[model samples]
Target: MGDLVLHLDNINKSFGGLSALSDVNLHVEEGTTHAIIGPNGAGKSTLLNVCIGRLKPDTGKVTFAGEVLTGRQPHEIAQLGVARVFQTPEIFQEMTLLENVMIPALSHRDGAFRLNATELLSKQGEVREEAEHILEDVGLKDMMMVEAASLSRGDKRRLELGMCLILRPRLLLLDEPTAGMARHDTNQTIELLKKIKSRGMTKVIIEHDMHVVFSLADKVSVLARGQIIAGGDPQSVREDPKVKEAYLGGTT
Candidate 1:
């Protein structure tokens, strides 16, 4: 196994009197794809929020790359090479797909939000080239100049994925990346993810698609009612009785 890139120890979170996550523990190995699955309201998203610093756990710790991550802001976590893709695609509606990807690269090179107009335009070629490379990687090259809002749903998802990829994050967290897509689109997204994985990215994904999980995950963790019920290789997780009863609805 690779070194641990992310560690969540005894994590717990609650909103008022409602418990969203309780004593949840997980470890993601470097360069491996780890999938977390659960039923609705199972706190899967909550766990992801905590991982990427969007939400803080009332108890327990989050560590990334041997550095303590508790209490860090989302951007701070992101700067530390963690990137998250939300369930809903959040692209700049007015910007071209190339523009969207260039934003991050420009920010990385010129400091966030501080680029002068002249300098920004001067850097545009480099940014566009880099963005186009990422778009190509995500299968979006032909749509580079298209307004993000004008793309089809799958293409928009691809654009969002491209945005995340440009960051070159050490760990990528995705929540329902294939959510709301048609079967063909979902499979395309799956192939894109597989291509990413083959390039040696470490990913932690929260997904409900068993096919995607089984095909891509090196390990699987099944959650129910705020705790992990079973965790192991994908095949074992698929066959795990407790997981079948609690989250998989006895599908196994």
Candidate 2:
């Protein structure tokens, strides 16, 4: 019932005659956490790739904040206030965490990558301060000066999240955010995501972790064999027979 922020209409995609998605339709409400979940090879990530312009649907259009995003390039879609967090943390391995966070903000503000980025990054005082604040927000301020390559897996993920937050995107999409993490790190991420939720930033997450989904998602959509099988509140999705069958092999 909330305002429609992102809409995927009649989406179909294939590769080498193998269907990855089939007539997929999804509606994400403004200021809500919408989750896409399914067993392995379920096309949840494909759906997100379509939204962010990484993959073009053979048929269907993606609408975001009243903008048509189907044919646009990935950066173009990003310009329209969409940001994605890949399953693996994408950061400059040799760069410090603070610099990693600043790069995106600087690119967004200047409208493109800068050849003299290193020079400008240092000169942008306010941006540096903001990046530091965001690093702290993601619990990386203590290690802001350390190289990203030296950080633990969980810290790298946190750094990537801080990088995304610097964009201030209207819609955020995450792919398997807690894929490989200790329980403590996963729980910390859940709390960070919850804090982000409190700020009313709309999110669409593709996660396998049930605990993460239940903790953060306002609505849950179950994808099976490239089609949605069930969608509703977390509790409802959890109790749905279709989800039980597809996600749990009909056990219990």
Candidate 3:
């Protein structure tokens, strides 16, 4: 097997008496796209939250790059090279796209969100150059000077991705990336993700779109009732009986 990058062992979580995760275990190989799929309330987001340090699991451990991350803070985990793209776009609607991208790029370089006005202005050109290059890569170079609020849904998602890429993260976790996208936009995202995969950035995606799942995932895991019922390569997992039942007789 490839060198493991992220591992979850016996992860469990709950609210009151409702179980969100139960003995959930997952292994993500380095430089691979691992997709996690489940119906609503199947604990997919909870598992991701645990992995990214947004929620501390009631029990179990999360390890990344050989270091235990179970108790680390979200920023601490990010410092360890993890980035997440939420279901909706996360950007500064009032700011220019270039400004939105440059903020994180600047933070990545300066080690935090503190920079004097003079120093910021002095470094603006360099940071702007880097942010522009990333925007180009994400196919948003033309929108650099435009207000973020004016971009289309797909473009907004692209901008959010650009923000994450500014960190040069080793692992990217995406939750429902194409949820509200049209077919054309979804296809565009697929092509963009294809490029990202070619660059060897490991990704763990939680999505309902089988087309998107099969398009990018190197391995697939299906979650149901807060547990993984089937997992393997795309073809095999797609044909698994338990997965079919979990998708309500294979409708999903």
Candidate 4:
């Protein structure tokens, strides 16, 4: 076990007449993968949005590394080392894969698209090297020069992962990183995530793929109707009666 890197206490959120999340409580330990699994409309993504400061909770608190994060803006949270990868892969359509990966690294060095030509040129070598290294780490080294929009769905996801990796975030929030991939690609994605966890990065993932969740998560939280009903080790959660009844539909 390690220090609690992310903590959510009694978090609640609503959209007019609908409650998206209610009394959600979660803690992710440093260097572990914690999975959030639930059926459709379970408020899983909404919870993530709140955690990363894309949405403010009506009540409760979000803390990261001892700092209160309830009302901070998304970019502000990113500056504090919280990175989010959305469900849809967000890549620069016209940019080369290498260039796409370099953007975040450059931002880290020169501050988010604020660089003048001289500053940009001075940091080019280090930023490209770092980006290329991340690409290699994510199995996209050979595709460095390809236009991002031309990538296959799986590779697009890899490129997105590389972008997040370049940030070296303390808390990584992934929304369905494996969605819509072929079986082989899904396994590859899982392997990539495992490699990331091995490097001691903390991850909190929202996923519907049970196989991936069971294989990679050290702990699992079952969310249904905007609340967590079970939280524990993967095997224990897989065996929980309430979890089976609620999300698993009586299947283990």
Best by lDDT: 2
**Model 3 ranges off by over 4 Å:** 113-117, 248-250
TM-score of 2: 0.95
- The number of clashing residue pairs in model 3 is 0
Q: What is the C-alpha local distance difference test score of candidate 3?
A: 0.88
CA lDDT, every model vs. true structure: 0.86, 0.90, 0.88, 0.89
**Candidate 4: RMSD over Cα atoms?**
1.6
Which of candidates 2 and 4 reaches a greater lDDT? 2
User: How does each model score on TM-score?
Assistant: 0.94, 0.95, 0.95, 0.95
How many clashes show up per model?
0, 0, 0, 0
- Residue 136, model 4: lDDT of 96
Q: Report the candidate with higher lDDT, 2 versus 3.
A: 2
Residue-level lDDT of model 1, residues 111-149, one tens digit each, is 545638555465478777887899889888887788889
For model 3, where is the 10-residue window of minimal lDDT? 113-122
Off by over 4 Å in 1: 111-118, 250-252
C-alpha RMSD of each candidate structure in angstroms: 1.7, 1.8, 1.6, 1.6
Instruction: Give the clashing residue pairs of candidate 2, or none.
Output: none
Query: Candidate 2's residue-wise lDDT over 76-120, tens digit each?
Result: 898888999988888899998877988887877877554763574
